[model samples]
Target: MKPSYPLMLTALFGLFALTGCGVVAPGLAAAPPTPVPKTHHSAAKQKPRTPSPVTVPRPTSGNELGVVPILEYHMIGPTEGRWQRTPQGLYQDLTWLYDHGFALVTMQQYESGDMNLPAGKHPAVLTFDDGDYSQFEWNSAHVPLPTSAVGVLEAFQKAHPDFPVTATFYLNNHPFGVDSVAKMQWLVAHGFELGNHTYTHADMSSLDASGIEKEIGEEQAYIEQSVPGYVPVSFALPYGGLPQDPTDRTAVLNGSYQGISWHFLGVALVGANPAPSPYSKTFSVSIPRIQVVDPSLVASSTRYYILSGYEAQFLQDPSMLYTSDGSPKWISFPQNLSAQLNPAYSSRANPEQ
Candidate 1:
């Protein structure tokens, strides 16, 4: 019933928003963000010069396209009760991420910026929404307990020490409790990062003006207290709606995340994001995220995502770069267009003579 970020994505009629051609994903939320106030740039006279062309990356090994495919998940347990995935399923997914060459990154790293195509490393983020009990359950439950989230990550990290890995979990207001905090501390010490999933996954769009403020203010306060040093800058729309954010500033104030986007980030059941264009296309609202579950899915998805391919060029200098909304391209690499001239245009009369 909720509209998703993909729904907000209206690519130049599919010229963009091309994740991978596969099965349709489930709905996370609905609606698009309302435009905010803007100020126009003053005009200034300047010398005339040739303008450079914008870039649409060609698909090739290394970085056919500049992007890193990140995967998002909810729960990992045997239940499959709500949005949960069994531990066995998680193991299958993680093992694939390892063998395939995805170097896991933490929120701290993301905050630092500079996401480049590290040599021989496929960078991808594994995020889990709603801090469910399943996280601690993986290794915590001894009687019939399976590998906890930490346990799985630990094993994966040990085996592939070369691949850097980390995960993000949005905790509710509920206390980490004495025991859970210790487990969480272990996760943080290892490499995991925690964030705020909005006090109780509260619906941002449905609330009134003042109501929206409270939702954010209250949740932020609780999240900060519940998880020490956990300052959330990103917010996942509860039920996936956009109408709430623009109407409210407090939300952004509390959630000042540098990268805020989401879309049909694939499902463990079926993957739709292919490499080369996985994270290449940009939509402010719904940035694409890959879903990691099946072993084959992980392997195939890795090949298709162009994280290690063109990211280097992009990082070196992002040409035609602009905000989420397509506007003026203020920066470029190699100082714009270079390559040889189209000589044919200069000598139309000669005609190859």
Candidate 2:
């Protein structure tokens, strides 16, 4: 029998308290909990699984040091809203991206600068936040609904095998309204990733050091418990709220609560334009994402807008976009623009004339 949402929450809350933390109500401040040694075994401490190698056509020329867009999405439903993208709109977006030479890649691949694509093809990161049920749902037969986000992605991938179905879903408590471990396992079993969005979606800016740790650490614990050996390498700040204190900010990047520690390689923000190439010096752990919403809802710097939307900007000057060199063994870019490359990737840098 499938576990009910309330029972799941009860178990999660019990684990939370046992970890020397208290359940934080949304928007309400809670007293700092004492830190205790983590007694629960976690596979998160183990090394993350390496992605399988993909073969693509070698590129004769392309810029590997250009910006890559990390598109942020919320709900996938019938009507588009400020935080929702209609299924039809999503299909259109995928079609447009594919036609424009954009290939789907996970946030992990983008952050690690390991996105290996065909010659002249750019990498695009798709991320879903909140983990709404509309984003993923199974019919009575246990198959993904045709209109759901996962279903759409699967269909698109079937149509275009080159555009692999891979994305990162940032989850909060009661993800997909079920909090089912099977759902989490299924996502990981496929190519999709599960990331942390805090336990209660608390605004980080309002949280103190302990609160911050509790929020992040509890979620980490939950994920580790739900999906053994699967540790979220990235963190998406709730409401894109960044802690004001420098130390608190550091805690967000790396923190521990009652022995349940978390170290995120990448921290995602709420809005703005495309992120700098991982090989670029401008790239950092704090990554910016472009909100995928209706063009009419937002004035400028919105989706589908030619003058202000990031899509148009990239289309206007494809050179500014990161085109894969088609090989993970080397990072390729124009020698003239070599100065922009981060020195850490110097060993793999392959600047061409």
Candidate 3:
């Protein structure tokens, strides 16, 4: 075997290098690929999801009318008087109403029949008399005082988050103390209602028709001018006094002075009674208010009687209440109570097929 030395050396080096580096020679065939096992398929499939059913209260039927309780509050401060309520007391009142599923509505809403509350909710009105400085007051820095009624309400609103923060303030000559005009504007701007309590807050019953005009008309003009866009639609009778004469009532109802006029929709008296439903015939002119006076006064008078006796019961049992359901305004109540309510308020009845 005679081979060239240099060629033999080069070939041997190449073979050794290939073997050391784990490389296949050019002439060698590649290794065969490994076989993969097949996976088994399942016959079962996933079922589609069914949507959740909408939750609504059981449908009620009848004509039983719901009674709305309008609570009347006077001064909101630390004063110890039957007509005044402490800030803590005001908070307690609001808390009780809110906890009992009562939605705070304005007198205007009550008058205009805007009583559309969500399901399982009742409407109640909070009214403050005299437009007392303690009812709504600001510090020297122009901030609401903690003891003020509005301050308590706003603070409560923040804490509860879902409670309706609204009320009506019956104003005489002064609104929320100093800077009366600014306070009036503040109330209107912040969704609060301003109502006339007469200019002098005098005994409206003793006043003649002209005197009533001066008291009411002048205040109306002042409020109109002060607030720019506010026109008080509701009125609270001064000292709960009403003019007995039909003529006097008419004048108070629609009186004009200084080119300004008052067309009061709802007139509140000093009496302690629950306001009839705005649907009632007597609701427009003689709306009654439940006074939130001293506990001693409650014992002496029946200020809390209507709400405690009747309205509270209605809230506890929706079957005894009349509320408009979406279309056709179906007033809901138990069928057995149909005799208790007026026929006009009842939902349409279907005859047997």
Candidate 4:
């Protein structure tokens, strides 16, 4: 058979464009991005858990930790760079998540007991690290460019409508490579979160207690100065490093420097599998993050390992994954994994019996 040259060329062009090849579709102008709603930061819906008329079945064996996959991304413009996701790839991710009933939530919400997703929808967290310029920047029209990460996310939300438009951005000193104050304030005003990634992206493990405090304190100070009243409760470790001393964990969790207080309920790691629910006994300071990268860039074993591993179970046997039935007071999961859940949040009924 003769080679389909046109089809082959189109596919090649798409593949190239995904890696920052700078290809624009001929004669296609992007529509202006939808204006983000100025909802109060605390407006997250929380429904009271009441007794259900119908009994919800308990899973015999499956994802029981109410595993909320927290995915991490570094750059958004190119697929070729390590830990970077192309614009098309990001859209594909949102589409897959929306189609599969995944509701987006902030790290703060995931750490809290007040989850309010639509019935039967699972929660996931989208986190961007290093605050790359490609994540969010204003164009000549002073509007968010559809090509940036924020722009792509807004466009995706508009197209899907039900997908949550929330994300947590962990920042270094040079936030998003734009006007730090404007972008940070914009994020807070528009339902997005700004988190500390250390002032200079310092490796915590190498730093002494004073150094670690300085690293964290300086970044927290900048954020407070830039966006008053926006206290950050989530932290992403620089280079995914933890301090050598056990006491350092407490410092990261709750510490004060130069009269400014800082605390975090969730501290993210550099790369690994998805995190179990915050209510899980296994959950801790070392929250793992799945890097958003093209498969070719990572080892075959690590490529989309978490998503591919849990996605099928989430769709067909959702009870295997962490899901809320309008109740945040008690932990929900399979009987087999009962031992893994935090006793504080586990159901009173003994799963062992």
Best by lDDT: 2
Candidate 2 per-residue lDDT, tens place, 79-153, comes to: 876667888888888998989988888888787766778777999988998788887888766577778888888
Each prediction's total of clashing residue pairs, residues at least 3 apart in sequence or on different chains, is 21, 0, 1, 4
Overall lDDT per candidate, in order of appearance: 0.42, 0.74, 0.65, 0.67
Predicted candidate 4 versus true structure: per-residue lDDT over 1-353, tens digit per residue: 11134423432333233223432221111111111234765545656566566355443322336777777776776544554678898888888888877788887777653556654677888998888888887776657778788899889888877676789999888687767688888889989988888888777778877888888888899999999888888898765556777666566767888987886766776555656666666556556665566666645544435345456556776665556544433344556776776666544322422
TM-score per candidate, chains pooled? 0.55, 0.81, 0.73, 0.76
Q: Name the 10 consecutive residues with the lowest summed lDDT in model 3.
A: 26-35
Give stretches of model 3 more than 4 Å off.
1-64, 296-353
lDDT of 2 at 265: 66
Better of 1 and 2 by lDDT: 2
- The most accurate candidate by TM-score is 2
**Whole-model lDDT for model 1 versus the true structure?**
0.42
RMSD in angstroms, all models?
Answer: 12.7, 11.0, 37.9, 13.0
- Per-residue CA lDDT of model 3 for 248-305, tens digit only, reads 7666767997688988776776545556555433334556666565555343334234
The residue ranges of model 4 lying beyond 4 angstroms of the native Cα positions read 1-64, 304-318, 328-331, 346-353
